[model samples]
Target chain A: MFEATQLNRRNETTQKLFRLALGGMTGILILPVILILGTLIWKGAPVISFEFLFTGPTKGMTAGGIFPALLGTILLVLVALLASVPLGVAAAIYLSEYAPNNWFTRAINLAIINLAGVPSIVHALFGVGAFVIFFKFGTSILAASLTLAIMTLPVVIVATRESLQAVPEAFREACWNMGATRWQTIRRVVLPNAVTGILTGVILEVSRTAGETAPIMFTGAAFFLPLLPQSVFDQTMALSLHLFVVSTQVPNMPEQLPYGVALVLISLVLLMNSLSIALRMYLRGKKKW
Target chain B: MTAMAPIPGRSTERSLAIRTSKLNLWYGTFQALFDVDLDIRQGIITSMIGPSGCGKSTFLRSVNRINERLGYVRTTGTIDVMGQNIMDPEVELVQVRKQIGMVFQRPNPLPISIRDNVLFGHRIHNAGKRDARSEEDGIVENALQTVLLWDKVKDKLDKKATALSLEEQQKLCIARLLPVKPGVLLMDEPCSALDPKGTEAVEELIWELRGEYTILIVTHNMAQARRASEECIFMLMGKVVEHDDTGQMFVTPKHKETADYIEGRYG
Candidate 1:
């Protein structure tokens, strides 16, 4: 009995040690995220002002503001969402609801996974090949938006499919037993329950599309377009590309200009993410079962 | 074959609501039901009783084509509902479903308001037609009233159907089907998820719905079958062993197998 008690004490100590190690590892994992956000806010907050946000850049991309870039980022994300949301959601619906469990469906699932894994630079080259040159859209917002849409389609499809699957099969069976067609069931039952998850995907796509510089650079983004884009066909200055240009390409640029642009871009993405999270919380509270 | 004509009072062939001739079903390579032939009457409660894995639920599902949702499920048979062959290629599924409503082992109310749940079937069947608000209210009230649930839930019509007690949810499920005016109701162990009180309440409600709709219920509880059903079917190994009037079958089971099963000798 004494030996058993001693063994139990040793096991307890070992378990406690393992728990502490796991906790420390978690802290280490989160440290970089905390440090990055802290440094960015500390360095970038003071540079952001209404004047800096609202006016156009001046003095050879050295001073004034990044309004054109901000507007271009917004436009790019909007058009990207417009192109991708419908296509992605439709594809996800087909994948989750209509597709039979066979090799063809498996191949489609594999393709989505591989598409998500492909490097951003490779996507940029493909975008240049397909959207910029092959389709003859030229270096314009439309081409960039299309490129970004394709790149983010996998994310939206996966997220939407997961949410669609999360809805209980019982619900679908119940609706079907009531003589509802597949489309009717999806429209009235499935889609409403899955909307919050789909919106979360769109929000993630917004953040990703807003931050990408490589694909948009060759497709439509200009190094320093002083004028805002008036149409889909016009080239525009993007925040990601502008930040790149201001920090590296332009000589003797203002010390805080790139920080301000970074701050705005980060803020935009964070704001979108926060809004989607709040919406998801509200929807969850309203969920009946 | 002596067990085939166990029910003495009612003629088996007359006024049939549903008839399955040489019914066979398979999930991929494995067969779940084999050569099932049953003549369910037009307006009575018939209960199917069997041990687990005996394909009673599968048989219930096949009546309304609900089993076809699974990709590998295949059925070769003629299920005629109200003298129309549901297996025919030209028969639209929505029409078949419109004529028949099903309740699952677990009560599945849509995650919507109680009022909307009642209107769902009517709205689906009558897609292009619009009803006045008062008309819809009447439909909801009448259906809920029929299920004996309106008095309990009348004040909270807009509340989520899922928020109700399990017994209420099950009753609401039965009530929702009434607005569609279906001729037959298929129930697959509808009381399996409820407590004793819930089961009793739902059983009483099912008994109340006896004459209006032909209810074919599958139950494991022998007592429920004896109390609520006019006729009872005993199945084992995916084959119907005996079917007869509930009183006669319980008092004088024709087959030795039926006697053993009812006497709790073996599953």
Candidate 2:
């Protein structure tokens, strides 16, 4: 009886200890996210202004605006979306809907899963090597966009595949039973049903590309673009690369300038993130029953 | 029993909605169906009844070539629908299935509104007749009325289909099939998932649908086979045990196995 009572007491203590440990670990994990956002607000809020958003890059020692950087970011993210959305979704449909449980399909899926886990900086290096050097885009906005497009392509494909897969097999079978051709079933039934999921994935990939700094840094992020890109052929300075140069690597700049660039970059990312969330919510609202 | 069966020696007024000659099916190396010969005549409910894994559903699917969609499944021999060989590589299954509609065990409605669910195939095959179809919303209304779902879902035509009750959904599936204007309806245990009331509704629909569509049903319920169907094909171990009119098969089955199955001796 004593041993039994002792065992129960020990188990209770251990269980309570585990709970405390887990709770603490969760707090620890959340600390960085909170701290990151908190610091961005603290350091970046003061520089927030209408002129800072609208005006062009500074001349000489003037703390000027980030319009050129902002333009590059917008153009590059848009280009990436245009490049990846259709191809990623098509690849997803092929994998999820068309590919049966065969070895070739399995291998292709495994390859995609592995590709998603490859480090972001390596993707940048590959972009510089392939797009900038080989393709001879020569550090232009087009090259940066292409690099970012490749980086986010895998994310879009995986998300799209999952969404397409979520469209119940019953729906496809229903289409088939109705005498719909295979392609017709995909177009009329499956694709429309999975559109929301596909849209959500595209938004997330767009978010990812919007803030990516390292890849653009090597491939197309010009140190100081005097003018906003009027065409894809022009070199451009994206906000992420600007934030990097201003905050950490600006060798001969005053303290407040980095804060201003950091503010603009943070705002851009937060906007993209919020837009992605709103898009998904709006889609969910439309999904009746 | 032999005397009861008029068993015409030589008759040639051949009329079959669907006919299978030595139907065999394989899933990889394992055979799922044996050499099975069967015919479905018009204006009657023919049921394939057997235990689980007995390929009753397989035979039903064979009639419409639905099994061919499965990558591992392979079928041999000829399944003829309306004198066209469904097994032939040249035969367009899309066209064949357009004439033979199916309602599965579970109700599956297109995720669109109730109106769209009924008119999906109608719009597909009958596009040139759209204005006529739209004017005759009566086809959708009448189909729903026949399935006993018109009263339940009459006001919610534009509402999402997934919100319906299971019985209503099942009936909607029947209503959905109506717009396709199929001559043969295949049901793979349509009422197996339903409650008593839903089962009764489906049974009544099967009875009500006598002239327009010939039905091939797969059922585990012996009483359903007896009450709902006119012709019965009893199968076990992937082989047909007996084939007869439901009344005769229930009363005086020639095969001992058939009698055992019908008499609740064993499946």
Candidate 3:
């Protein structure tokens, strides 16, 4: 009986040790994120003002504001989403819902994986070759947005496929048994259920597209634009590229300007991620079966 | 138990509701069913009893072409439902599904409200044809009432169907199919996930639906088969070993294998 009690005590101690190890690891992982956000807010909070957000930059991008850049980033994200969401979702539906288990499907899956792994700089070069030069869209917002869209297509496809597959197969079967066609099953039951996951993917893509400087740099973003882009064909200043320029290329730039840009970019991403998370929670609450 | 008379509205012509001729199925290289020939009559409850992996569920799925969803599955032979050969190249899947409804081992209602769930199939089948708001309300009421779920859910038709107990969810699954007006219902171990009370409640509801729809139920429960089905089919090793009236099959099975299974000597 004494030995049994001793063994139980040993098990409890080991369990507590395991829990502590896991908690410690979590804290270690989150430390960098907290430090980064804390540093950005401390350095950049005073520079963020309403006029700074809504006016064009002045004095060689050293003083005035980043409104054109901010608007350009939003436009870039919107156009990329418009280009990729429909195509990516359609491809995902084909892969998850209709693709036969054959070598062809396997090849498509491999292509998607490889496309995702390709570097952002390589995608920018491809955009220049294909969209800017070949298609004559020129070094413009359309070309840059197309490059970003292609780069992010795999993310959307992967997420959409996972969520579509996550929908219980039984739901499809039930709908089909009631004489609903395959498309109808997807439209009425599968898509509605998977919408939350799909939206999360799109939102994540928004943050990713917003912060990417490499793909948009050579393809569309200008070092400094006096006025905002008026059309898809126009080159525009973007927040990420603007931060890069002000921090590295410009001489004697205000110290807080780059920090403020970084702060806004990160905050926009965080806000979108939070919205996706909230939507997921709401949808999960509504899900039955 | 005494023999129950055939329910009213049953086809007096004694026609077959479902007919399978030399039906065989395989999942890739693994054969799950072999030469399953069955002629299920219209408007009666027929139960299929077998041990696990005996191809009872496989047979039911084949009738509705649900097995084709698997990429490697291959089926040969013909399935005729309501005089139309479903295996024919020209027969649309939508039409076949409209004629047959299915309930699963577990209830699977959409994440939508209960009323929407009931009207889902009807809306799909009648796409582009607008129904008056009141007519839709009536359709929803009639289907739920037939499943005997209207009273419990009437006050909150807008509530999500998943919030209900398992038994109610199962009933809602059945109610949802009714609005589509399927002539046959395929039940694959419908009560396997339910408690005894839920099973009894669902079984009673199935009995209530007897006169209007033909039902083919696959169950592991021999007692359920004997009590609920008017006719019974016993299968072993993916082959039908016996098909007879429920009373006859339970009292005096013709084959030794059937007798052993009924007498609890073997699965």
Candidate 2 structure lDDT:
0.82
Q: Pick the candidate with the highest lDDT.
A: 1
Q: Residues B1-267, candidate 3, lDDT per residue (tens digit)?
A: 121122336677787788888988998998888898999988889999988899999999888887777778899988888777788877676776776789999998887899888988888878837589899999999999998999999999999888898999999999998887778899999999999999999999999998689999999988899999989999999899899999999998999988888888888
Superposed model 1: Cα runs more than 4 Å off: A1-12, B1-14
> For model 3, what TM-score is found for chain B?
0.94
Tens digits of per-residue lDDT, candidate 1, B33-120, equal 9899999887799999989988899999998898888879999989888777888887788877877899988899999999999999
Q: Give fnat, all candidates.
A: 0.84, 0.68, 0.89
**Comparing 2 and 3 by lDDT, which wins?**
3
Sort the candidates on DockQ, descending order.
1, 3, 2
TM-score of chain A of each: 0.94, 0.89, 0.93
Task: Return the TM-score for each candidate structure.
Answer: 0.94, 0.92, 0.92
Can you write out model 3's per-residue Cα lDDT over A1-289, one digit (the tens) per residue?
Answer: 3466877989999999999999999999999999998989999989999988988888888898889998899899889999999999999999998888799999999999899999999999999999999999999999999999999999999999999999988788778788777788888789988988898789878888999999999899999877778899999999899989989999989889889989988887788789778888898777665
Model 1 DockQ vs. reference? 0.76
Compared with the true structure, what per-residue lDDT tens digits does model 1 show for residues A41-62? 8887887889889999989988
Q: Which portions of model 2 show Cα errors greater than 4 Å?
A: A1-12, A59-62, B1-14, B127-133
Q: How displaced is residue A133 in candidate 1, in Å?
A: 1.3
